[model samples]
Target chain A: MTKTRLTRRALLAGTAAAATAATLKAPAIAQNAPIKIGVITDRVANSAMWATLMGEGVELATKQVNDAGGVLGRRIELAWEDDQDRPDVSATRARKLIGDGVVMILSLSSSTAAQQAQTATLEGKVPHMSPSHSADTLTTRLNNPYFFQMGPLASFQIRTLMAYAGTRFRRVALLTDNSALGTVNATSFRQGLQQGNIQIVADETFERGVTDVTPALQRVRAANPEGIFHAGILGAEMALFFRTYHQMGLRQPVLGSFNLSIPTYLDLVPGLLEGVQFIDVYDDVKPEVVDFANRYKAVHNKDPFSLPAYGYDGIMLTVDALRRAGAPDREKLRDAMHATRNYTAVIGARGTTIGFAPDRRIGFPENGCVVRTIANNKHGHAVWRGLAAS
Target chain B: MTDLLELAVSILEAGGIYALMALAYLVVLRPTGIINFAVGEWATLASFFSVATLGWWNLPYIPGAVLALAGVAAIGALTEQATVRPMIERGAPILTPILILLGMVVVYREAAALGFGTQNLRVPPPLGFGRIDLGPIAIPMQSAVVIAVSGIMLAGTWAFFERTIWGKAFQAVAIDRVAAGLMGINLRLVAAFSFAGGAAIAGTAGVLQAPLTSAHYLMGLPLAIKGFSALVIGGVGRVEGCILGGLVLAACERLVMRYAPIPSGFAIGVPLLLMILFLLVRPTGLIGARGRT
Candidate 1:
């Protein structure tokens, strides 16, 4: 009977009123929808050799957060993509993830891939974090406010390592594989040595996957440096370095970058790494790390060493920020991430905390870097802590 | 002079590895005329299997290595049957199969990575990591064993080609696939067997080279490149050429790295330079392909 009196204008007004009502109710339905987080991991690229472990770390953290009841009373659902370690693909994947209503993205691919993904993340106004990349240029290459890096920078590791070993060897040799990251590490290590006023006796690089470096090692032996500072990450090449080192009967102490901190070497070089020392974040015996290691052991039946702890800390901190933001809104959540301080993570020294200050995008403290010795072919005791003064 | 002597002995071990990798390519290329770039992945897969059997499952070295080789051979044969055979049957150009084989390289590589995670799996050298001294010259124990095993493999492959019926069939197919088929040679069988043998050779090289390079998913590409370079320098026609090419390539690389005034990084290009020189001087390689009856 009421509709019998309806005109075209009245009908249009009624439909508009109903549409507005549905729009108002949309937020209530979205409130219970799971918070979407994206992770770009590489499983097919060369970086996958280490990225797999980092991705596993990311997986475990996401699992723990979900098991503990996700943020803001909404379940946290993770969207995963493989970047194939290509920077272009990485940017494309980042855009795809951001387009899918993701609040934030974690790049667990190569540093360059992560760096490239920043373009998309910045454009989308989504907070992005490279939780385990150590490329110094990752932060400085772009002035994007949305990007934060938590990995120990090469400069920090180099300086800390120099503080521990530079005084003992005034003349050092720089060695690395021809990998992009390997070259980057070696360059910084050279700088770190120069800053310490140490003479660089020889510089060498070997191709990855080649079985023989004895030819190259012969030259290093001829140089007769007091120490060999290596920055290689390829397990095979790294092991070859050690094998060639021993084969040539060279007795120089081999100091390494954080690459040695990875547990793969223990399985690879084995008996070869007796007196080798390398730089790392800190001791794994810290209470937080022990807990993380225990959790890892419960599932994997083997205690994790260095990489997974970083992932756990990254996710835990991100979750805390999301909670502090009180909603999954991107701007508010990024602000909360920016305001973070005094946060605890399983990475770095026991007392060292990860946070963003007003002027710094690097979350890992400079002094948090440590130098550890390989004992029994394991990531051994931390012999020194904090960054070395220039 | 002492350093030079030490360096010379090291090349024997390095060259043997490149030789086997070259043989892997040759084994497939001879019968089907398709350059199987996937040989490196086959090698890597075998290395992973050997690691699993010997390291993880605690199988004895002989059985583990054998199982790995046999399994990869089967996979290689299956690959030919699945991919190569169908293309040939459909009258596809040789380039089609070569392109397809390139695609298989990625497939096999990703399969390897998925099947075996990227952890560094060490295949402990059968001979311990000690040094063996040849009078004034010194060699790693693993290197000597690897060189000896490589020699035996080369001899065995030589005997097969020169003395066995199947090897003759392989050669005949390489000479003329259609004519060989007309002569009652099973083209499919030849193709499959050649692929299997090629893959096994690759597996052998991988296991032997593990001491130096270690085993990982990413280990294949470099092996493929080195082998390809050796192939280019050695020529594909003669089995002996593979060994010759590998030795020359290794010698060039080592000599450059050790004696060249250039930085160690530049030494990497020595193999390519040598290959190019060979191409210019002897386009057919150091050992020209002999006419097979």
Candidate 2:
């Protein structure tokens, strides 16, 4: 084992020497032999919008990094593959990216796809980082040290939202659609509510394409819950719920999950979301986030949301680890990535930094989520600063 | 008391769209004996048209809706020409056209997705947002509009079958395709018209419902399933059966949501469960096809 380590170190040293001698300028290195990072994203599945935004974030960050002297004196190059939102295809894409000599892989698809991609990534021993997959089981399902997760965990989101909810609501209703992600969020929210000893007065679900959510909301109103937990993710269904809620004239405050963190709802369900609070990963109060938003808008000519920040942070974090590793070796880079602590990204709550303990591979802290409420149907301002709010 | 009134309005509003979707399926099923799952996609397409006209162009609701429905009807005729007529001409099996239409469903969705991105396009309600009072019942304006529209459509459909010669021709063709052909009724014309009407009906549903759900590519499948289930529950026979099936399905689903002790997640399966139950117990549905006599 000692000899193997020595040989690996020697090989890495020789590669580093060659990389240094190849080019003095980062652009020259980019033109010649640049460091490659693979990104797996869903381009056409249910989460396509989220994936596209995240991919754009990755691109913007990579461009910025390459503009400056690239990581470890070599320019950063990205190899992107569409997983098509299928787990099996994601696994195949992971193998393909590894074959293409990607030093590390960043996944911006569903948690299922990210988990499946880890199978190939684990075998290849390549470091894989999922920027936005929050399922707690992703890192726990496999004991692969090569994989790391860095998003607001479902548990974290639920806890944060519930914390924002406080003791003001004794009896609350849980609302979500039948979509898989919505169902998962509802289940997680239920567990969080139970643990917090909050009484779930009503639990309701509606089909996605239905014209009305009144029956469900009426039931919720009948139960006379103090507040309603909106856990549904589908934009259309959520709009229906809000509209029905307003039409029914129910005065209960609505608390939404991280799904409402998506800015798409601001446009889709305008006027109906006034005073409704939802868990958010993006905090405008953060200097880093302000800088990211200003730069992103200047580049894309549009306001940047949190979805892209997840991708941006994933690539930035990967590069940070590579810079620390000082070489293109996979094992060394994995160790460097796992050692990350207090690294701030554009997407979390103010004062929350990206950190991973020795045993835990999930990089996002439990307190890194905030609750934001919609006002005037345009802006979603941060209402509760962080999860620490009682 | 107010909650129950609101619930009744909600059920009526939902059932109206379901009824229209069921009628769309029944229109094609009656004469062609083919289940065109593509009606759902046609509804999705109409929603895009509404988005273009109503949302983008800021057209009035009536004109925008009419144009969208007309566009969908043309697409239906074109689709029948492209997919159905050729298969029928070659004397393909019944399943062949059904499967082909199923393939068209994917084509329509992909076309929409490629044309309009995966984001949900905002669709404003036709009569604007808010509520109206019909005596003691407070109903959303959009829901009230939906009920009115579906009533007109059902009335129109019933009148055509009962009052018009073309409607009798359609009935003749549905009764016995070969016998109607022998009677000199143009089967091709009837088939094309049936599909066009079906598309128009489906497009109407999409346009009316778009205010609530918005225009989306993935929105087609759930509608197709729910509409198909309604068709099965109402039976493939009469126009009234479609309305009956839709109302019954909506009522059952809503009641389950309001009262079922199960998790709300399980309530979503009520429609499917009802469909399965109907298929098992009353395969002919609540109202089977109208007799030939």
Candidate 3:
């Protein structure tokens, strides 16, 4: 009888120990399972650099998360699809990612492509975010609850720049190219100027191909406004604009849209952009930014631009939502993403954090825009970070 | 008056580049009567070659430029042999070669984009970015270099067409292809020479202008349109007419933008408007054929 009781107790203890060991092994097995995420990018387009920079940030952030044991005990796996910056291609890629069973999708393409991808995300009920597109239409054009935009909208950029330059110049001239984005940015800028009661002394536009901008510059020179607002986004056209502006000896202060935040200009338009201030979302002096830059450079062997911060924040935000949801359930993830608040954004001005309200899908704060100066052919420091109401 | 002087300088600076492209169009159009829109793509290809030889390999400007232009000329000859010659030898219509050249434009652009990617590539100016002042008139050194080089090229081209026996053969072919063929001039050889010369001129324009605009894959279409407009405005008959058309088109474009009280964006329409006006009102163009009577 004593031997039988001892054997029964041993069996009970052994069963309980085996059950605990199995429970621990379960998570490790799940951790080895890859939680696939999809990234739609423009690998070959006019805006390839921006796409590359954004994708680099995503890759860097994804590595960091996996290093930290990943979300929900699963390693994050990124499946990439090149959109070629075409809207149709972007939509098709988004659907294909959904079909491939990705938990979420991140897009870093033009606003048009991003907006098109929204249709696929909405139909598939998968959460989607665009980290670099600035067009306001991405959120407003579609009531896709699963879609979110993180970049500063065109209106926000123009308004922020106007607020920064308030009372500095009563009359300002606008210079932009005929490219679609340039035209759109210029129009938003025009509307902002009109609302500010500022006079536009001259409005000049140049084509993408013509190297000579002097005729347009001559007209602007004749008008002789107190300042010049550059809304052109094309690198070659903007280079022509600055070269012409410098050659014509125009002394008026030149302010630019947020497009200047692109780092390619530092190399493309050297020595021509000094003394020019452009609206940006990055504050180089921020500690978080410095840390991110260091880590990114260590991994990529190159300095990180402000644009990458958006991509980093995008992946982090999605992972944070995933962590809160604790499962790959699309509905729960969507709800968690929509509830994001007080999250620290690596990009944007000081004191600004990314959040999405119940009513709004655009995640960037109103005060996130900052004005940065260019000096010695490189982006300098933030000159102004406004908290004024939009 | 300063504005006027500066405007004139802008015209010259722009016209110089446009003239080179217009002349490229004229070269092929004169002898073959086939409008090769691929000249712009040839220029863009040369720009990419410059980026490789000059920017990547750190070659000196003169040798780098000669290599790029020569490479494009050879490519042009290959293109003629592969696409144009075969089609013509098969008794295809004149429109067949034109259409084939159009197809080559897309092929060349895609090849460059695939090889170099779609980023804008920067080439340092042959001269530094400083400006040279001619009294009250100031010109960027690159612009002045472009003007000087284009002037020499245009003069050389004029002499080639007028003074050289081979050039006279091209003119004779332009006047009447059947008569020139009847006169024992090899049509195939004439076609190859025209394509080679045209491609070289276009490539020179690309190498010179790449510093200003950066060599991009998408730069070809706009250039092709502008060059075609220049051809339409200057007339296809004379080499000098091509240069004259480029200058006039550039001048009118600037002058209208400067004094027309039109919105700055409207200035882009000036070239298209001029092209249409020339096609509708002055189809023979500003300089018609020398022996039209």
Name the candidate that leads on DockQ: 1
Window of ten residues with lowest summed lDDT in model 2 chain A: A23-32
DockQ category of candidate 2: medium
- Residue A193 in model 2: shift from native, Å? 2.1
Q: Considering lDDT, where higher is better, how would the candidates rank from best to worst?
A: 3, 2, 1
Q: After superposition, how far is residue A322 of candidate 2 from its true place, in Å?
A: 1.7
How badly does each model clash, as a count of residue pairs? 0, 1, 0
Q: After superposition, how far is residue B37 of candidate 2 from its true place, in Å?
A: 1.2
The residue-by-residue lDDT of candidate 2 on B106-170, one tens digit each, is: 88988998888888888888777788877777788988888899889988998999899999898
A289-380: candidate 2 lDDT, tens digit per residue? 99999989989999887888998999899988988898988999999999999998887888889988999999998988888888887656
Candidate number with the higher lDDT (1 or 2): 2
By DockQ, the candidates rank as: 1, 2, 3
DockQ scores for all predicted structures: 0.66, 0.56, 0.45
Evaluation by TM-score, superior candidate among 1 and 3 = 1
Worst ten in a row by lDDT for model 3 chain A: A24-33
lDDT of 1 at A146: 91
lDDT of 2 at A115: 88
Q: Between 2 and 3, whose DockQ is larger?
A: 2
Off by over 4 Å in 2: A1-27, B291-293
